[model samples]
Target: MIKGSIQEEDITILNIYAPNIGAPPYIRQLLTTLKGEINKNTIIVGDFNTPLTAMDRSSRQKINKETQALNEALDQMDLTDIYRTFHPKATEYTFFSSAHGTFSKIDHILGYKSTQ
Candidate 1:
Protein backbone atom coordinates (compact mmCIF):
# COMPACT_ATOMS: atom_id res chain seq x y z
CA MET A 1 0.00 0.00 0.00
CA ILE A 2 1.11 3.59 -0.73
CA LYS A 3 -0.21 7.00 0.36
CA GLY A 4 0.11 10.58 -0.77
CA SER A 5 -1.53 13.96 -0.62
CA ILE A 6 -1.86 16.86 -3.00
CA GLN A 7 -2.79 20.20 -1.57
CA GLU A 8 -5.55 19.30 0.90
CA GLU A 9 -6.61 16.05 -0.73
CA ASP A 10 -5.29 12.72 0.53
CA ILE A 11 -5.07 9.58 -1.58
CA THR A 12 -4.28 6.00 -0.73
CA ILE A 13 -3.03 3.64 -3.42
CA LEU A 14 -2.77 -0.12 -3.20
CA ASN A 15 -1.35 -2.76 -5.48
CA ILE A 16 -3.07 -6.04 -4.66
CA TYR A 17 -1.43 -9.43 -5.10
CA ALA A 18 -3.77 -12.39 -4.69
CA PRO A 19 -2.75 -16.00 -4.37
CA ASN A 20 -2.94 -18.33 -7.37
CA ILE A 21 -4.78 -21.11 -5.56
CA GLY A 22 -7.78 -21.21 -3.17
CA ALA A 23 -10.16 -18.45 -2.20
CA PRO A 24 -8.47 -15.05 -1.95
CA PRO A 25 -10.13 -13.50 1.05
CA TYR A 26 -7.12 -11.22 1.34
CA ILE A 27 -8.34 -9.09 -1.57
CA ARG A 28 -11.62 -8.34 0.13
CA GLN A 29 -9.88 -7.93 3.47
CA LEU A 30 -7.55 -5.35 2.04
CA LEU A 31 -10.49 -3.40 0.63
CA THR A 32 -12.18 -3.50 4.01
CA THR A 33 -9.02 -2.37 5.78
CA LEU A 34 -8.51 0.51 3.40
CA LYS A 35 -12.16 1.51 3.57
CA GLY A 36 -11.83 1.78 7.33
CA GLU A 37 -8.93 4.21 7.00
CA ILE A 38 -10.32 6.34 4.20
CA ASN A 39 -11.29 9.98 4.52
CA LYS A 40 -12.19 10.46 0.85
CA ASN A 41 -9.61 9.45 -1.73
CA THR A 42 -8.30 6.03 -2.64
CA ILE A 43 -6.85 4.20 -5.64
CA ILE A 44 -6.60 0.41 -5.64
CA VAL A 45 -4.98 -1.23 -8.61
CA GLY A 46 -3.69 -4.80 -8.91
CA ASP A 47 -4.03 -8.37 -9.92
CA PHE A 48 -7.16 -9.43 -8.04
CA ASN A 49 -6.62 -13.02 -9.32
CA THR A 50 -10.37 -13.52 -9.16
CA PRO A 51 -12.80 -11.54 -11.23
CA LEU A 52 -15.59 -9.77 -9.39
CA THR A 53 -18.02 -10.52 -12.24
CA ALA A 54 -18.42 -13.07 -15.00
CA MET A 55 -17.38 -10.51 -17.60
CA ASP A 56 -14.10 -10.01 -15.81
CA ARG A 57 -13.06 -13.62 -16.16
CA SER A 58 -13.30 -15.82 -19.21
CA SER A 59 -14.81 -18.66 -17.21
CA ARG A 60 -18.47 -19.66 -17.23
CA GLN A 61 -18.53 -20.45 -13.49
CA LYS A 62 -20.63 -18.70 -10.91
CA ILE A 63 -19.45 -15.56 -9.12
CA ASN A 64 -16.95 -16.36 -6.39
CA LYS A 65 -17.58 -15.40 -2.76
CA GLU A 66 -14.39 -13.42 -2.31
CA THR A 67 -15.22 -11.52 -5.48
CA GLN A 68 -18.60 -10.61 -4.06
CA ALA A 69 -16.93 -9.55 -0.84
CA LEU A 70 -14.60 -7.29 -2.75
CA ASN A 71 -17.56 -5.84 -4.63
CA GLU A 72 -19.38 -5.17 -1.39
CA ALA A 73 -16.32 -3.55 0.11
CA LEU A 74 -15.97 -1.31 -2.92
CA ASP A 75 -19.61 -0.29 -2.60
CA GLN A 76 -19.13 0.52 1.08
CA MET A 77 -16.16 2.65 0.22
CA ASP A 78 -18.04 4.50 -2.54
CA LEU A 79 -15.32 3.37 -4.87
CA THR A 80 -15.87 2.54 -8.52
CA ASP A 81 -13.95 -0.02 -10.46
CA ILE A 82 -12.91 2.56 -13.02
CA TYR A 83 -12.08 0.15 -15.77
CA ARG A 84 -15.49 -1.45 -15.67
CA THR A 85 -17.26 1.79 -14.99
CA PHE A 86 -16.00 3.55 -18.09
CA HIS A 87 -15.64 0.60 -20.42
CA PRO A 88 -18.89 -1.15 -19.88
CA LYS A 89 -18.98 -2.84 -23.26
CA ALA A 90 -15.27 -3.00 -23.95
CA THR A 91 -13.65 -6.32 -23.22
CA GLU A 92 -9.96 -6.29 -22.48
CA TYR A 93 -7.57 -8.37 -20.43
CA THR A 94 -4.46 -7.70 -18.47
CA PHE A 95 -3.60 -11.35 -18.14
CA PHE A 96 -3.54 -14.14 -20.68
CA SER A 97 -3.62 -17.91 -20.39
CA SER A 98 -1.41 -19.94 -22.69
CA ALA A 99 -2.97 -23.32 -22.10
CA HIS A 100 -6.55 -22.11 -22.39
CA GLY A 101 -5.82 -19.58 -25.12
CA THR A 102 -7.88 -17.06 -23.27
CA PHE A 103 -7.52 -13.56 -21.86
CA SER A 104 -8.92 -12.45 -18.53
CA LYS A 105 -9.08 -9.04 -16.96
CA ILE A 106 -7.83 -9.84 -13.49
CA ASP A 107 -6.20 -6.48 -12.90
CA HIS A 108 -8.26 -3.50 -11.80
CA ILE A 109 -8.14 0.19 -10.97
CA LEU A 110 -10.60 1.25 -8.31
CA GLY A 111 -11.03 4.74 -6.90
CA TYR A 112 -13.54 7.11 -5.38
CA LYS A 113 -16.45 7.84 -7.74
CA SER A 114 -15.63 11.54 -7.74
CA THR A 115 -12.12 11.01 -9.03
CA GLN A 116 -11.09 10.43 -12.69
Candidate 2:
Protein backbone atom coordinates (compact mmCIF):
# COMPACT_ATOMS: atom_id res chain seq x y z
CA MET A 1 0.00 0.00 0.00
CA ILE A 2 1.16 3.57 -0.84
CA LYS A 3 0.90 5.87 2.14
CA GLY A 4 1.75 9.57 2.24
CA SER A 5 0.46 12.92 3.25
CA ILE A 6 0.53 16.25 1.41
CA GLN A 7 2.11 19.29 3.10
CA GLU A 8 -0.07 20.04 6.12
CA GLU A 9 -3.23 18.33 5.05
CA ASP A 10 -4.60 15.45 7.07
CA ILE A 11 -5.60 13.64 3.92
CA THR A 12 -3.61 10.47 3.23
CA ILE A 13 -3.41 8.26 0.17
CA LEU A 14 -3.59 4.50 0.45
CA ASN A 15 -2.77 2.26 -2.45
CA ILE A 16 -3.80 -1.37 -2.85
CA TYR A 17 -3.03 -4.10 -5.39
CA ALA A 18 -5.47 -6.94 -5.55
CA PRO A 19 -4.84 -10.26 -7.23
CA ASN A 20 -5.96 -10.80 -10.84
CA ILE A 21 -8.69 -13.34 -10.11
CA GLY A 22 -11.51 -13.39 -7.54
CA ALA A 23 -10.55 -9.93 -6.31
CA PRO A 24 -13.63 -7.84 -7.01
CA PRO A 25 -15.80 -8.93 -4.14
CA TYR A 26 -12.95 -8.78 -1.69
CA ILE A 27 -11.91 -5.38 -2.93
CA ARG A 28 -15.40 -4.04 -2.49
CA GLN A 29 -15.47 -5.37 1.05
CA LEU A 30 -12.05 -3.90 1.76
CA LEU A 31 -13.13 -0.53 0.48
CA THR A 32 -16.20 -0.63 2.65
CA THR A 33 -14.12 -1.48 5.70
CA LEU A 34 -11.54 1.20 4.93
CA LYS A 35 -14.20 3.82 4.39
CA GLY A 36 -15.45 3.11 7.83
CA GLU A 37 -11.99 3.53 9.35
CA ILE A 38 -10.67 6.65 7.62
CA ASN A 39 -11.86 10.16 7.08
CA LYS A 40 -14.10 10.80 4.13
CA ASN A 41 -11.39 12.70 2.23
CA THR A 42 -8.86 9.89 2.17
CA ILE A 43 -7.62 8.84 -1.29
CA ILE A 44 -7.04 5.32 -2.57
CA VAL A 45 -4.93 4.23 -5.50
CA GLY A 46 -3.83 0.88 -6.89
CA ASP A 47 -3.71 -1.78 -9.57
CA PHE A 48 -7.15 -3.33 -9.30
CA ASN A 49 -6.38 -6.12 -11.76
CA THR A 50 -9.63 -5.49 -13.57
CA PRO A 51 -11.02 -3.20 -16.24
CA LEU A 52 -14.35 -1.85 -17.32
CA THR A 53 -14.03 -3.17 -20.87
CA ALA A 54 -11.81 -4.34 -23.67
CA MET A 55 -11.48 -0.68 -24.57
CA ASP A 56 -9.80 -0.07 -21.24
CA ARG A 57 -7.19 -2.65 -22.22
CA SER A 58 -4.21 -2.23 -24.49
CA SER A 59 -3.90 -3.89 -27.89
CA ARG A 60 -2.13 -6.85 -26.29
CA GLN A 61 -4.40 -7.03 -23.26
CA LYS A 62 -7.30 -9.34 -22.65
CA ILE A 63 -10.10 -9.11 -20.06
CA ASN A 64 -13.00 -11.27 -18.92
CA LYS A 65 -16.47 -10.84 -17.51
CA GLU A 66 -15.14 -11.11 -13.95
CA THR A 67 -12.78 -8.22 -14.59
CA GLN A 68 -15.63 -6.13 -15.88
CA ALA A 69 -17.64 -6.99 -12.81
CA LEU A 70 -14.81 -5.79 -10.59
CA ASN A 71 -14.76 -2.48 -12.40
CA GLU A 72 -18.46 -2.17 -11.78
CA ALA A 73 -17.91 -2.80 -8.09
CA LEU A 74 -15.52 0.13 -7.94
CA ASP A 75 -18.10 2.34 -9.59
CA GLN A 76 -20.70 1.21 -7.08
CA MET A 77 -18.41 2.40 -4.29
CA ASP A 78 -18.20 5.89 -5.78
CA LEU A 79 -14.49 5.75 -6.49
CA THR A 80 -13.10 8.09 -9.15
CA ASP A 81 -10.26 6.93 -11.36
CA ILE A 82 -7.45 9.51 -11.17
CA TYR A 83 -5.09 8.05 -13.74
CA ARG A 84 -7.22 9.49 -16.53
CA THR A 85 -6.94 12.90 -14.93
CA PHE A 86 -3.16 12.74 -14.53
CA HIS A 87 -2.23 11.06 -17.79
CA PRO A 88 -5.02 11.24 -20.28
CA LYS A 89 -2.78 10.50 -23.25
CA ALA A 90 -0.71 7.81 -21.60
CA THR A 91 -1.60 4.13 -21.22
CA GLU A 92 -0.95 2.66 -17.79
CA TYR A 93 0.30 -0.92 -17.60
CA THR A 94 0.89 -2.44 -14.17
CA PHE A 95 1.26 -6.14 -14.76
CA PHE A 96 3.26 -8.19 -17.25
CA SER A 97 3.40 -11.96 -17.09
CA SER A 98 6.34 -13.18 -19.12
CA ALA A 99 5.27 -16.80 -18.64
CA HIS A 100 1.76 -16.22 -20.01
CA GLY A 101 2.81 -13.62 -22.58
CA THR A 102 -0.08 -11.48 -21.46
CA PHE A 103 0.04 -7.77 -20.80
CA SER A 104 -2.81 -6.12 -18.96
CA LYS A 105 -3.71 -2.59 -17.93
CA ILE A 106 -4.73 -3.38 -14.36
CA ASP A 107 -2.97 -0.51 -12.66
CA HIS A 108 -5.00 2.47 -11.48
CA ILE A 109 -5.42 5.33 -9.04
CA LEU A 110 -8.88 5.74 -7.53
CA GLY A 111 -9.87 8.55 -5.26
CA TYR A 112 -12.89 9.22 -3.10
CA LYS A 113 -15.18 11.80 -4.65
CA SER A 114 -15.39 13.67 -1.35
CA THR A 115 -11.69 14.48 -1.60
CA GLN A 116 -12.17 16.56 -4.70
Candidate 3:
Protein backbone atom coordinates (compact mmCIF):
# COMPACT_ATOMS: atom_id res chain seq x y z
CA MET A 1 0.00 0.00 0.00
CA ILE A 2 1.25 3.48 -0.91
CA LYS A 3 0.48 5.95 1.85
CA GLY A 4 0.15 9.71 1.34
CA SER A 5 -1.81 12.66 2.61
CA ILE A 6 -3.14 15.89 1.20
CA GLN A 7 -3.67 18.50 3.88
CA GLU A 8 -5.56 16.59 6.60
CA GLU A 9 -6.81 13.83 4.35
CA ASP A 10 -5.08 10.47 4.42
CA ILE A 11 -5.03 8.09 1.48
CA THR A 12 -4.03 4.47 1.06
CA ILE A 13 -3.07 3.19 -2.36
CA LEU A 14 -3.12 -0.51 -3.25
CA ASN A 15 -0.66 -2.05 -5.66
CA ILE A 16 -1.88 -5.27 -7.21
CA TYR A 17 -0.67 -7.75 -9.79
CA ALA A 18 -2.96 -10.37 -11.22
CA PRO A 19 -0.53 -13.21 -11.77
CA ASN A 20 -2.39 -14.63 -14.74
CA ILE A 21 -3.91 -13.02 -17.81
CA GLY A 22 -7.37 -14.42 -17.02
CA ALA A 23 -7.37 -13.39 -13.38
CA PRO A 24 -10.02 -10.69 -13.44
CA PRO A 25 -12.61 -12.67 -11.54
CA TYR A 26 -10.19 -13.43 -8.74
CA ILE A 27 -8.81 -9.89 -8.77
CA ARG A 28 -12.25 -8.35 -8.59
CA GLN A 29 -13.10 -10.61 -5.70
CA LEU A 30 -9.94 -9.59 -3.94
CA LEU A 31 -10.69 -5.94 -4.49
CA THR A 32 -14.16 -6.41 -3.08
CA THR A 33 -12.72 -8.00 0.04
CA LEU A 34 -10.14 -5.22 0.40
CA LYS A 35 -12.62 -2.42 -0.15
CA GLY A 36 -13.79 -2.79 3.43
CA GLU A 37 -10.31 -2.21 4.82
CA ILE A 38 -9.90 1.13 3.08
CA ASN A 39 -11.70 4.34 3.93
CA LYS A 40 -14.13 5.57 1.34
CA ASN A 41 -11.76 8.40 0.48
CA THR A 42 -8.63 6.31 -0.02
CA ILE A 43 -6.83 6.19 -3.37
CA ILE A 44 -5.76 2.92 -5.03
CA VAL A 45 -2.91 2.70 -7.47
CA GLY A 46 -0.48 0.28 -9.14
CA ASP A 47 0.16 -2.14 -11.96
CA PHE A 48 -3.12 -3.95 -12.54
CA ASN A 49 -1.65 -5.69 -15.60
CA THR A 50 -4.87 -5.17 -17.45
CA PRO A 51 -4.61 -3.50 -20.82
CA LEU A 52 -7.29 -1.11 -21.97
CA THR A 53 -6.33 -1.49 -25.60
CA ALA A 54 -5.21 -4.31 -27.84
CA MET A 55 -3.60 -1.71 -30.08
CA ASP A 56 -1.42 -0.49 -27.19
CA ARG A 57 1.54 -2.45 -28.47
CA SER A 58 3.93 -0.01 -26.90
CA SER A 59 5.51 -2.99 -25.13
CA ARG A 60 7.09 -6.39 -25.78
CA GLN A 61 4.13 -8.31 -24.38
CA LYS A 62 1.29 -8.77 -26.76
CA ILE A 63 -2.08 -7.41 -25.59
CA ASN A 64 -4.41 -10.39 -25.77
CA LYS A 65 -8.16 -10.94 -25.35
CA GLU A 66 -7.77 -11.81 -21.68
CA THR A 67 -6.11 -8.45 -21.00
CA GLN A 68 -8.89 -6.62 -22.76
CA ALA A 69 -11.46 -8.52 -20.66
CA LEU A 70 -9.60 -7.63 -17.49
CA ASN A 71 -9.68 -3.99 -18.50
CA GLU A 72 -13.43 -4.23 -18.86
CA ALA A 73 -13.68 -5.70 -15.37
CA LEU A 74 -11.76 -2.73 -13.98
CA ASP A 75 -14.04 -0.35 -15.83
CA GLN A 76 -17.07 -2.11 -14.43
CA MET A 77 -15.63 -1.70 -10.96
CA ASP A 78 -15.41 2.06 -11.57
CA LEU A 79 -11.67 2.43 -11.07
CA THR A 80 -10.32 5.62 -12.60
CA ASP A 81 -7.05 5.50 -14.53
CA ILE A 82 -5.39 8.70 -13.34
CA TYR A 83 -2.34 8.63 -15.61
CA ARG A 84 -4.29 8.21 -18.80
CA THR A 85 -6.72 10.89 -17.69
CA PHE A 86 -3.97 13.43 -17.07
CA HIS A 87 -1.83 12.37 -20.01
CA PRO A 88 -3.82 11.87 -23.13
CA LYS A 89 -0.73 11.37 -25.28
CA ALA A 90 -0.16 7.76 -26.31
CA THR A 91 3.64 8.04 -25.90
CA GLU A 92 3.40 7.58 -22.13
CA TYR A 93 5.08 4.33 -21.10
CA THR A 94 5.48 2.93 -17.58
CA PHE A 95 6.69 -0.67 -17.62
CA PHE A 96 9.86 -1.81 -19.41
CA SER A 97 10.59 -5.38 -20.44
CA SER A 98 14.32 -5.83 -19.83
CA ALA A 99 14.45 -8.69 -22.31
CA HIS A 100 13.14 -6.60 -25.19
CA GLY A 101 13.33 -3.03 -23.84
CA THR A 102 9.69 -2.65 -24.78
CA PHE A 103 7.88 -0.11 -22.65
CA SER A 104 4.19 -0.18 -21.82
CA LYS A 105 1.77 1.84 -19.71
CA ILE A 106 0.83 -0.88 -17.23
CA ASP A 107 1.35 1.14 -14.09
CA HIS A 108 -1.58 3.29 -13.01
CA ILE A 109 -3.14 5.34 -10.24
CA LEU A 110 -6.78 4.61 -9.54
CA GLY A 111 -8.96 6.41 -7.02
CA TYR A 112 -12.25 5.82 -5.32
CA LYS A 113 -15.10 8.01 -6.45
CA SER A 114 -15.29 9.75 -3.09
CA THR A 115 -11.62 10.75 -3.12
CA GLN A 116 -11.51 11.79 -6.77
Best by lDDT: 1
* C-alpha lDDT values of all predictions: 0.73, 0.64, 0.61
Candidate 2 root-mean-square deviation in Å? 3.4
CA lDDT, candidate 3, residue 95 = 65
Q: Specify the poorest-scoring 10-residue window by lDDT in model 1.
A: 31-40
Superposed Cα deviation of residue 114, candidate 1 (Å): 4.3
Tens digit per residue, CA lDDT, model 2, 3-106: 45578556667777787677666677677677655454567777776654454556635556665566666667766667765666666566676866655566
Off by over 4 Å in 2: 1-5, 38-40, 59-63, 114-116
* lDDT agreement of model 2 with the native: 0.64
Q: How does candidate 3 fare on TM-score?
A: 0.62
Model 3 clash count equals 0
TM-score, predicted candidate 2 vs. hidden true structure: 0.66
Error of model 3, residue 8, in angstroms? 2.6
Q: Which residue pairs collide, candidate 2?
A: none
Candidate 3 worst ten-residue window by lDDT: 51-60
Stronger candidate by lDDT (1 vs 2): 1
- Estimate TM-scores for all models: 0.79, 0.66, 0.62
The TM-score leader among the candidates is: 1
